[model samples]
Target: MKQGIHPEYHPVVFMDSQTGYKFLSGSTKTSQETVEWEDGNTYPLIRVEITSDSHPFYTGRQKFTQADGRIDRFNKKYGIKDENAAE
Candidate 1:
C-alpha cells in the first residue's frame, strides 16, 4: 500500500430523508453538513432520497402491471384465441 496517496476514510452518517433513518459507516466521501450521532460523536451527514426504509421493493409495496389484462385486451381487439381456449 502507498502512503499519503489515498483519500482519508472516516465515519459518515447517511440519513434517509423520507424515513428519517440515520446510519453510521465509514467512507472516503466528505460532506459540509455534520450531525451528532447517538454515540455523541459528530460525523459528516449525507442525505439520500431513497433507502431500504422507503423503497417499494424493500417495503413489499411493489405494484406489478397486469400482463394478463393486456393480453386479453389485445386478443379481444384482434379476435385472437389461444389453442387451449379454442379447443
Candidate 2:
C-alpha cells in the first residue's frame, strides 16, 4: 500500500485477433494503439492471439486423442509384446 510504488491500473480493451472479439478490463499494461469502446470512451488496445471467446475448449471444438492405456501405447510404439496380453 506504499504510494508511488505500484504501477497504474486503468481500464483497457483486450481484443481477440482471430474472432475480433473485444472486452474491457483493467490492466497495468500499456499500448500505443487505442480503441473506442461501446461506452464511447477510448481505451488502450491490446491484441491477443487466443482468448476464451475463440479457444477450442471454450467453443467445444477441441479434439481428443485416442483413449489408449499407457501399457498399450508403449507396446504399440516399440512393438513390445506383453506375455499376459496373449493369455
Candidate 3:
C-alpha cells in the first residue's frame, strides 16, 4: 500500500429522490453536498436514481417476463389459433 496516493474512502449518504430512501456507506467518490448521518457526523451527500432500496432487483420489484398476452394478440392478428381463442 502506498501513502499519499490513495483516495480518501469515507462514509457517505446516497439519497434516492423518488422514494426518499437514504443509504450511508463508504466510498472514494467526492460530492459537493453533505448531510448528517445517524452517527451525528456529517458526510458527503450523493443523490442516486437507483439504490438497494429502490432498485428493482434488490427490492424484488423486477419486471416479470410476458408470455401470454402478446402471443394471444399475435394469434388474433395472424389468425393462427382456433376461433374460440379469438373470443
**Strongest candidate by TM-score:** 2
User: For model 2, what is the error of residue 5's alpha carbon versus the real structure, in angstroms, after optimal superposition?
Assistant: 0.8
Kindly state the number of residue pairs that clash in model 2.
Answer: 0
Residue 1 in model 3: shift from native, Å?
3.4
Q: How does candidate 2 score on lDDT?
A: 0.95
Distance from true position, residue 1, model 2, in Å?
1.4
Clashes of each: 0, 0, 0
Q: Write the per-residue lDDT of candidate 3 for residues 1-87, one digit (tens) a residue.
A: 989998878888989987989988899987999999898999899998877788897888888787568777798789887756447
Backbone clashes in model 1, listed as residue pairs: none
lDDT tens per residue, model 1, 1-87: 999999988999999999999889999889999999999989999999998888998999987876578788898889987777755
Residue 15 error, candidate 2, Å: 0.9
State the lDDT at 42 in candidate 3: 91
What would the TM-scores of all predictions be? 0.67, 0.77, 0.63
lDDT: the better of candidates 2 and 3 = 2
Model 1: weakest 10-residue lDDT segment is 78-87
Better of 1 and 3 by TM-score: 1
* Residue 79, candidate 3: alpha-carbon lDDT: 80
> In candidate 2, what are the lDDT values of residues 1-84, reduced to their tens digit?
889999989999999999999999999999999999999999999999999999998999987787989889999999988887
Choose 1 or 2, whichever is better by lDDT: 2
